[model samples]
Target: MTKKTKSLVVVMAVTAMMLAACSGNGNNNGEQATAKPEATGNTNGNAGADKQEEPVTIKVLAQFGRADLTENEKAFFQKVNEALNIDFQLVIPPSSGYAEQLQLTLISGDVPDVVFFPSEQDEMFINAVRDGAVIPINSYLENSENLKNYSYEHSWEALKTMRDDNIYGVPRTSITRNDGFMVRKDWLDKLSIEIPADNEVTLDQFNEILRAFTFDDPDQDGKQDTYGVGSYVDANKVLLPVLVSELGHYGWQKSTDGSYPFMLPEYDAQSDVYKNILLYTQKLYAEGILDPDSPLNDSAAASERFKQGVTGVIRGFAGHVNAQEKVLKEIDPQAELTYLFVKGPEGKVQGTGYGTGIWGVWAVTAESEHPEKAIQAFDYMLSEEGWDYLYNGIEGVDYKLVNNEKVYNPDISRGIATSIMRRHNAPEFFLDPTKFTKEELDRVSPWVDKAVATVVTSMDKGYVPPAAREPQYMDYKLTWDELTTKIMLGDLPIDQLDKARADWYKNGGEQYLKEMNEYIQSLEN
Candidate 1:
């Protein structure tokens, strides 16, 4: 292999080996991105090159991207203050009011230095760019000395997406694409179990495995202390969980071969896929695998179960396993956790975030002291060094580079993320793919490979119509959150699922699909 190739391999190997050592930082916010960077990523007295002069307090607007800062974040930032000379007066708003609040603030003509958004409000931002509501970040990419050396992957898609004159705000791509990873590896070890080497298993066999984990005394507690399987989130968060537990068990997409066509049961305002999934969920509850109280449990309670060791087998995507394993180690220290990915019918499972192949497209208002300065700042965010610090956190504190790539310390620092979900608002997480590094890719490769391998062996995963996801179509999805878990986790019989599906179709389901097909066709046009 080439030296570059060999070096990449070593970096990945080191990260994989040390994954257990680095439990991981949990975001105070509910979700988004891979992992936020720690404030002062200073390791071994070197945080890469020196930063430029620190400016006065920059009034920055941090959209409600994360929950809040932990004590660790504060400590790291305190250290940062020692070196840098700027106060990042962050403006964090609630998710519900993020766009509205931003608009209100802008109308008052009092915008922050940095304008952040989680999911892009493309329409408003586009108009803002036209009206000069945002400061362009082009110059920053070239001039900002502090951010010029930032490392990590920053895809072109992200870079281009966050621009108007093709020059706009900085894009801090969140790491949300990695999902459907990790299972109870420690449990597997305790049971002296070996995973299905093939990665592909029929729904029935997958069910049996979950039952084995839940029913069998793998832990040897004697009593029927384990559940066959479990689910999380009152609604959609739990979808991926079931997908993980059962692997190729029950799903809407069908096939024994070829690509799983995106078959979202044509949202027949009469036969919607959303309700169909819900009905099957109810069946899972009837079978005694799903947690009934999942709907009522707050984020803290739900996450605590996995962290404290009450739930042995659980599933989530992206950083879920990494973070969970970290908590497990702290709880018991020797906790052995594994993320055995699930397979679909067509056997094409992947443990990355659903591809949002779009640029972030941040705009600047015409009214600003340094419109070019704003663009320059954003450009810095997109630079190699800017992304490196953002992705890896303040250098030595978070990682050290033996090779050209980043080698994390398991304790990768993300000073941006807070400790509590509702306490402080974090606005910097805007996920764009261009910012990923080969090291990051290598680090998560094994689990992702397993996911793909599972798909290879599974039947098929037909595409679910994207219409059910569009804003207009989503409005029709009545079986959301609380109601969804209530029905799915209850003792609903499997036989009634068909009628429920039909009922959903009658309730705005068909319109959802019509809108979807129209939208899809328009894209082609």
Candidate 2:
């Protein structure tokens, strides 16, 4: 159980099954119904003609999005040209600095063949559409055999909202992150407490178990040292379902009236939800049952609490299963942890997907003389060969599937080391779940729960599409995030909840609702 012993064990990556990606250009999650005139329109933006033989290098204008890829990344890029016989000069910057860069590029009349954009509330993309900086790609849809098929097979509603009659770029699809409670099972056995069904314990019931685990001295140290829950406020943990639920609304829950939009209180707090969340917070606050500093702690701090045997419950997404097991094993050599799906206030469960934002978008610049090559390059990314190349660098170099499950070619590690921006799991980006085989999913799953649970498929997964972005509505999102944090932290008077809702209306919350209504109704049409 020493750090030395833990460091010696090579923790494998999370099971690779759940990695999931996009609809098409004009498939923005924005709220709107941009009408289109069918696919038979005239030649728009120089659609392709079969295959072009010219080997011209097209320059792409990508947003500040692509990773600061490590050596593994460079190898993967090389593989694209080696396998697909296509070359592209990807023009991507950092995602954090992308918006400002995109603006300057647009003004300069230099646009990428494809740019990563949110169908909802992305200012740069909207402005580009208004100024004709981006091609209305709906007409281009007809020429795309792969895209047309992908669009029809999947729901087209999201794509429809992003554009009128032209598809601009491809819409990024996402995976619904199916995750749950991260409890150290070895400790549970020590305490002889039954592991709840798929770890689905009710709020009160979960607290009872956590309290026993923490205070009853399950560790047998005979000290009043353990806490019920372990959590942190770091970026990754902030988006987690458990932390998300505590604040209100991480998973998209629907309302009875279907009139009010579902919101994670932090991301989208409904008035009623916020009021109810107070009761839970009040309970934890009063019982001294929760970690007092969870609000300030980051993921590592919270996880450390669990490792130190100071807290019982550690909630996180599915991917953490493997890592959690690895870390906690140092505490108890037999530590085992599994996914626990989160139950909402109503006791119903919901999961989140890969955001339809920057992570999934990749682009080629308009500056390229060979725009056709850019499309081809992107299409190659969607191909099985391209995906495999991305997942692991050039075969026999970065990795080799000895028995089917990929094992890195030890030599590849010499030239490159793994880090945040790059890893062997890169292929999940374009691997089509529709085409995903059980073996493939097992090989590339992002979360450990993929084997135990099937991800829920949904056409309406809180995506508002491109036309959904309105100035007033965006303000509502901003204000809601700001105020909800204040309310959760007890900075705002609890009674101010109603006033906040009204203020929402005054500050265009009402218009936002109306806009959402129109988009929802459009689903019917």
Q: Listing every candidate in turn, what is its Cα RMSD in Å to the true structure after a full C-alpha superposition?
A: 13.6, 13.4
lDDT for each residue of candidate 2 in 97-120, tens digit (9 for 90 to 100)? 445445555565544445565443
> Candidate 1's C-alpha lDDT?
0.45
lDDT by candidate, in order shown: 0.45, 0.49
**Per-candidate total of colliding backbone pairs:** 95, 54
lDDT per residue, candidate 1, 277-343, as tens digits?
A: 5665566667666554455555566567666655565555543455566678887777766554445
Q: Return the lDDT, model 1, position 230.
A: 50
Q: Highest TM-score among the candidates is held by which one?
A: 2
Which stretches of model 2 miss by more than 4 angstroms? 1-52, 61-79, 82-85, 92-104, 110-120, 143-163, 196-205, 231-274, 298-304, 328-336, 342-349, 352-360, 363-366, 392-394, 401-405, 411-507
Global local distance difference test of model 2: 0.49
For model 2, the run of ten residues with the poorest summed lDDT? 11-20
